[model samples]
Target: MTGFEDEIRRRLLSAQDTGRIEGLLFHSTAEPIVGRLHGDGLDVLWTARDPWVSAQYIPNAGSEILLARPDDWRLKDRVAPTKHDVLYALACEMSGKECCDVEWDWDGRAKSWRVPDGWPTYGDVVGHIEDHYGYVANSNGVYYVRESAGVVMPADWQIEGQVFVALDDGLHFKDVRRSGEPDLTEREYYDGYAFEQAMAQGYDGVIINDHCQADDYGNVPHLSFGLNAIGREKVEWLALPAVRRHLDPWYSGEAILTPDLDEWLADFEMEAVHAL
Candidate 1:
């Protein structure tokens, strides 16, 4: 066992004697001594063997503290865990820590906590399709065709009608008279359209798959979403419990003796609680 594992084991035993630890959670790579923390006043509520296991069971385990080890996959290659962030955020919230609030940099080697760039945006939905083809506007509706495909203006085209203008490889709609200018009407239109569609379907927000390769390197293709104004309000309302729990002193990292196991742990720890 590494010295860090020994330190964790020692702290677990010390916390057990003082009753500071009520439950424990660890990654599958953790040593047997870590598991020994259980069965003696400390209930081992979870042993995260895989991402799915952690997602399915960790929320149900009301562990007072979490001690996670790095996953085996992360050690082999530094693949980005796109899907795991939500689960980690959920876990952090469950353990009374606010997710993405602080910059968690452990030992200067792990990814820090921040809103991921993978989150979808309006451009990803209606943007151009590389250098070859893009969306163009007409009376019939928008259609994806070869760039500058010699599209003749429709008979009904008017000065006030919507027109497509390409800027930064994104399709932007504008008033026919202002086609030469780049403005934000396209974003407003799409965001409003997405909001309406989601509301009509009784959803709080819209999840979109980004085909534009906008995600961080090594991340798998993942679904991303944005909450409309009303959806954001509803989420904030529902998250009051988590916010309060994060503020509760009882859930603070004071009881976890190892500084590395505290709330300061970075985003990479989501897979394995221990630093690699």
Candidate 2:
């Protein structure tokens, strides 16, 4: 095992109270309290006010924290974990690390890889990680999604769900009436739903009434409903004109209405041509 994996083993083995570590990563710092945004007919909503962070006095989940500062890159506010961090955790696992040097770029020359016979390639492993963790804290209904900025009222918010599928080409909507299930990734499902609805209803995108915003590259497709962890009966969908009536009181109760995306705010005029 490489030095990275050794570090993970060291941390895990040296911990006196593993429970504290879990709570620090999983549990809320304080009760995530918020009041509902009352409107005409809003029902349920989840407003993300902050990025999930570890608290000294909070309960933790079983997740581990990997802090790796990669070379030639640094964030002004925060940094994403690196390959070393991932390997470190894997090395300490019950099965130990597999294909430890499959992706080692020791020669400093790009396009060099070592593939073990009959085993899945390094690319496959990397793809899996990218697909899952890329959108760790997003605005999609499930998982950890944060809201965007400029949000104040209920109407200027969103209800993230599986409505459409955004692929390498463009956006494709799932005809819930026609198609039996959503046909895209979890990240795409929520984004596609918003895109199709906005385009169909003659709106630009989900407007932001909150104080958070970012680009669309970080979002992953929303998985199909009623499968895996997304066991909900149906996907969530909220539109611009219908937000106020559907978001209910976000700050109150157990629900909140955080804007899914701010980059979607790009100007796009929608037109209506009825098929009558």
Candidate 3:
């Protein structure tokens, strides 16, 4: 067996001693290489959680070996847009729209857009004059426009129903739905999607890089195991120095450990001592 396969076998045997061994899930392309795990009395499957395999023994296994990269996991979290993002979105909305050329009235204290005598002026107005642009509330509200531009009146200037909602601070805006989640990198997204699918079906952790692949892809070698809370507890031997030395060489630098796993590993040394 290859050195990589030998390392995987050693870890799997240790996991089996703790009763944490379940079937191994790998890409079909890796079938020939990892088929030896089956001879050790462990189940081995190459379907890698294909829907048809959902009812098979792999899904309900407490902790199965999944051949994958942790960095490829694509979980998403929601975040608020920055002030610049809101401004850019607003500018994009107004880039080429035309508005009426209105006049501005200076009341000594502040200057405001003055609609034509017969024009209805009840809502907010946002426009640019020559090279300057800004937002102005109704006649009774505040004006934040910059100096000098051909003022144009928007017949029905309304922004509330669109992409942005003015924040309580009045000067800032956020997404109307406030549900804008940043997109994940393509590989991360698909990886996360597949991991989630496996988790939903009851698998608890992944054994990364247990298969053979060319090393020219520029990905740092990450040969660690990643476990959810339950899997970590079940496969505690994974924390051993002997096991970790084989896995940790490129883990921190290249693998994107999930927040939960990161926290668990941070405190695991103490936890393991206490368990002893």
- Name the best candidate (by lDDT): 1
TM-score (C-alpha, index-matched) for candidate 2: 0.18
| TM-scores of the candidates in the order shown | 0.18, 0.18, 0.18
- For model 2, the stretches where C-alpha displacement exceeds 4 angstroms are 1-57, 66-84, 87-97, 100-115, 118-122, 130-250, 255-276
lDDT of 1 at 22: 28
lDDT of each candidate versus the true structure: 0.28, 0.25, 0.27
Residues 15-56, candidate 2: write the lDDT tens digits: 323312110001112233234221111111222212111111
Candidate 1 vs candidate 3: which has greater lDDT? 1
RMSD of 3: 24.3
Off by over 4 Å in 1: 1-192, 200-202, 211-220, 237-262, 265-276
For candidate 2, the 10 contiguous residues with the lowest summed lDDT are 19-28
lDDT: worst 10-residue window of model 1:
236-245
Candidate 2, residue 41: Cα displacement in angstroms equals 50
On the 0 to 100 scale, the lDDT of residue 93 in model 2 is: 29
